[model samples]
Target: MAEKPGLVKTRQERVETRLRQRQVYNERMSKKRRARPRSLNIGDVVLMKNRRPGSKFKTRFESGMWAVTRVKGTLVTVTKGDEVVTRNISCFKRYHGAPADHQESGNNSDHEEGECEFGRVGGTAEHWLASGNLQMGEGLAAQKTTTPGSPVPNQDDVPAEAPAEGSNSEATRRSGLGRYNLRSRLTLPERLRDYVCE
Candidate 1:
């Protein structure tokens, strides 16, 4: 089909108007950021800003540390384990500490060969176990059972009705094996740790 002579100009004008509006919006927002520019580099670890729920509580500026996987235009992509999230540049703040990946690399060799690959040197799991601060039904036996070499068997490994070989295995299975949430296992960089806690 042939275009009407008058219609072409109208279409071009509409596109131009939209572009102009977008440019204006960008300029207005960028003006504030320009005063203290925080340009993100690849491999720079940043904490994504989290909005608080409707409650009588305020949250910290930085919530979770995510690795800068990619940057395109005004968008940044970050990853934590299997979770990959993309947000606008304004949604993240530059982490003023060692990167999460760097910290993990430094400590990866220190851990025992068969210990669970979760958390930092002193974390919630360790604290709870060491202090013997757990529920009434759950005892220290469950905590001691998961040794470096032999982890608690999964649901597929042992039948619910059947008993295991040792008392440790029995306690582990009864206490619920493979129950730890990976999300909670997330750890922060050492430098950033003190700042966040404060």
Candidate 2:
């Protein structure tokens, strides 16, 4: 009768140990497994995987492009002209073709057609430019004014002449290592001593 309680206790301990081991195993596997890419949307261009047996020279995906018409769970419906086909999401790879508007306009709407003459000033300008929320000039202008504690200087206050050698101007300081200067100009012997040669 006493053995019954001992057996029950040991059985419960074994089950708990199994649960803990399984939890740890699952955590380890989850780390190794890659997260799936973003789901395909309607109107997305995709290439269907070629399942036919072929030589090494044959391409993995078919040459023709297919436009995603519908996405229902794991299944995706794609059409190329009159021919329509339904296949698993894994069988189709997203195709990033040139935008229809870009083709028609002959210019990319995302990027303005102008040289960015000024250097990027701050994080606000970088963020705005990256997000496409502001144009290059507009972002730079915003950066100049929006920066706290820094007073916006008028056109009259700007210096006409470039800073002389040894001057500690803001532009001089920011230019740093990239700007060619007499100090950075080193002899072959000095270069060998300073830098590690392959």
Candidate 3:
């Protein structure tokens, strides 16, 4: 049989196409985890990592519950009863622990003994974060007053949770004091620049 001229080249092209498809699939899988930070208003019930398991990893869950009055970084500062927990994004599963029914028809929403609706806080979280402190003490210790004059917060902007002493100033800097003095002549996209944190 006559040898084909581009058979080898054709096979190489096929492999490259498959590799690109696989990359797209992997990107899509990770995309779901990258949810945009939204307004987690006060009193909004949220779930966090349940680290205080009595036993080993065999019988532990990650569906911690609390109410959000403040949010910073990936942490949503929440208060549950007398205890206030500031959880990193890892320890949080928003919207009532990922609606059980929204998942599958067979899975149960209720928390389990050996596992949980969400997941567990991995060791990497502690490694990545400097302060994972939970304060449920006196009035000043619990409340955050980062905003100037400590004006009473309405619905969207709750009373500033007690940020670390210098943290507030840092937050202010990060909150875009530098960006204000940008080249005023530069034109920024309306939607792109309008991420006013409610």
Candidate 4:
């Protein structure tokens, strides 16, 4: 049987949509490739705009900056406002703004390898570990342990389990590793540190 006119239009629309999306993606990728740096690290703030209606700031810096809180290969984690962004080093740095807490968070060690987007002098995981700040490759929140003002573990390498909802991870104590819902953005470690500040 011959194709129906409705089906033809529908198929055409789908093809058009796919082509448009692919074009946009290609443009973005090429732009990133042209702009990426040799190395990338944590704590760099990207300058990309992600403004919406009724938002506070328009620019990334004014919007609280996109801090390169975590880095692992092409996947670099950055945060600005309520938005947590993860992208490749080149893509992120190309549009990233100035960082927040660049020095304190980025350069935990003096003699180490790799770059830190947050600070000028990049260090290594070992350096950060030596400083007693817990960090992972990516996806780490700015939270600390009992000593206060520490970084949260990025993944299950440390195995931080989130408390079974309803139970207050903070006020209520648990035996094992976990990430308690302490704040809108921060996990239990950051919340614990805030508790100290308070």
**Which candidate number has the best lDDT?**
2
TM-score of each: 0.34, 0.37, 0.27, 0.24
Evaluated against the true structure, the overall lDDT of model 2 is 0.60
Worst 10 residues of 1 by lDDT: 131-140
> What C-alpha lDDT do the candidate models reach, one value each?
0.57, 0.60, 0.50, 0.48
Per residue, candidate 1 scores C-alpha lDDT tens digits across 1-198 of 998787566777999999999999988888866744549866665677776545547455444456677899779998765578998898888755332222334456755765533233333233233333322222223334543334446659886775545544756546544343343456878877766431
RMSD of each: 24.4, 16.7, 22.2, 21.8
- CA error at residue 149 for candidate 3, angstroms: 48
Question: Which lDDT tens digits does candidate 3 get at residues 1-198?
Answer: 888886656777999999999999878876877756465654455556567766675433443345566777766787755677776756665543222222232454553555323223221122112222222223222233333234334557656677666444766566654445344446667886875433
Model 2 bad stretches (over 4 Å): 1-37, 99-198
> Model 4 shows how many backbone clashes?
16
lDDT leaderboard ranking: 2, 1, 3, 4
> How many backbone clashes does every candidate have?
0, 0, 5, 16
| Deviation of model 4 at 103, angstroms | 13
Best by TM-score: 2
Greater-TM-score candidate between 1 and 3: 1
Between prediction 2 and prediction 3, the one with superior TM-score is: 2
Greater-lDDT candidate between 1 and 3: 1
Per residue, candidate 2 scores C-alpha lDDT tens digits across 50-163 of: 988388888888866666778998899987766789998989997542222112333335545552211221122233223343222333354445443344566799879876
